[model samples]
Target: MNASPIFHRLALLAPLLCLGFVSISCTGYQLQTGRPQALTHVKKISVPLFENKTLVPRGEILATNSVVDAITNDGTYHIATLHEADAVLEGTMETITYSQVRSTRLDTLRSEEMENTVTLHWQLLDASTRKILSTGKATGSSRFAIDANQQTARQNALPDALQRAATQVVGRLTDDF
Candidate 1:
């Protein structure tokens, strides 16, 4: 019996597929995101309180602490004081705005969305040389609406906005992508 064209192709592919499986069974390498090579030399980092150019009270402190938390969560970089760091990450908060996103249709107008947004400029530098290795601007926002617990919603959203902004800054600093 003569083999059909489709059968012939399958016969050729079958051996290759078997060979691939055999190779994998014998030895293999798993894909992974290894340590960030760029940050390898950076043993410690100093993130001082960011410069707050806006009127948000304690905005600088919030931004600074959020960045510290992000880096600490990364577990690759050590957080150090400015005097004892390999790199210093300096950030400037350019502006922050809270705006009403929407208003209710009810007789007494109520805010449906309160958006908190922050824009920041950041730089990573060699602590000793003061050479800037990286710098850029990033913005992040978070929103809260009038809910059953208005007080809790307001309290959570503002800090969430700041935290989101700070996380983006950290990602920008370390991410190779």
Candidate 2:
């Protein structure tokens, strides 16, 4: 019932709790493992036209749009069209592999499910420092079903697959950089 006990307990723990908070806040200053190296003057970013090394003709456009979207959406840096920006993101679509993974039957094995996998290799470079800030790969896969018509199903699945791949690639680039 005495106020003295409560005051004594608060005084005892106040310093320890303050120290813990201070340590937590200070930890943010340390560089994370894959974080981009610190820049001295660069504040803008330019993502060059991505090269689509894959046979798929649209791969380059999709990857480029994804990177630009991700970077602009984050609002962390200025997105630039000129190559003189602080950082540049470059990407290559290595492969786009498709396969029929499963066959389903509503009445008889007439419906089939197919999957498409897309793999991309990307790097973030610090333009000023000429250093590779981060390098990594990302992959995404999507599946769709075809009933009696293989071509139609494949056509329908392509957009979905490309979108998924682009999203994943963007996520990996941002998270790593």
Candidate 3:
């Protein structure tokens, strides 16, 4: 009878012991909510329309929109109008290039896969002083199959490239990477 009661007490306590161990194991984990030291003072930023130096039409709109969208999604900085912003992000779409990534086995001259790359030059400036705080170049690329409609395929991949470049720019600005 004594053994039976002891076993029952241990059985009831096992779950609590297990839970305690789990909680203790997680004590080292911590939530990260702080920004990088370099950008701690910047809270709101404004992105202007990117200048398109490339030959592609409307490339500026796409690049600018992509950066704005990325900044909005990062949640590190608030998007504000030029008048209300603490900083201004200016970008120029410098180049859009396409290269053959993979050639068809049957034809060396034919491209089976192609990569689209977008290069953007950006500057972060103080809103009040118009002084450049940071400047960098970000490049983004996307690979796509060269289907029968090569133009359509290239067009579809352009946005992805722009988005990647935008993300890199934002990461550099906020994460200091």
Q: Which candidate number has the best TM-score? A: 3
**Which lDDT tens digits does candidate 2 get at residues 26-108?**
97596544323443344677888888887766668777776677666665556886666877778887887887677554544
Question: Each prediction's TM-score against the native?
Answer: 0.72, 0.63, 0.80
Question: How does each model score on lDDT?
Answer: 0.80, 0.69, 0.91
- Please rank every candidate by lDDT, starting with the best: 3, 1, 2
The candidate that achieves the highest lDDT relative to the unseen native structure: 3
Per-residue lDDT of 21-55 in model 3, one digit per residue for the tens? 99999997986544556566778999989999988
lDDT of 1 by residue, 64-139 (tens): 8888898898766789998999999999988877788888878336788788787888988999989887778878
lDDT preference between candidates 1 and 2, better one: 1
Question: Each candidate: RMSD to true structure?
Answer: 6.5, 4.9, 3.4
lDDT for residue 154 in candidate 1, whole number 0-100:
61
Model 1 Cα displacement at 1 (Å)? 37
Which segments of candidate 2 are over 4 A away from where they belong? 1-43, 105-111, 147-152
Which portions of model 1 miss their true places by more than 4 Å? 1-38, 106-110, 147-155
State, as a TM-score between 0 and 1, how close model 2 is to the true structure.
0.63
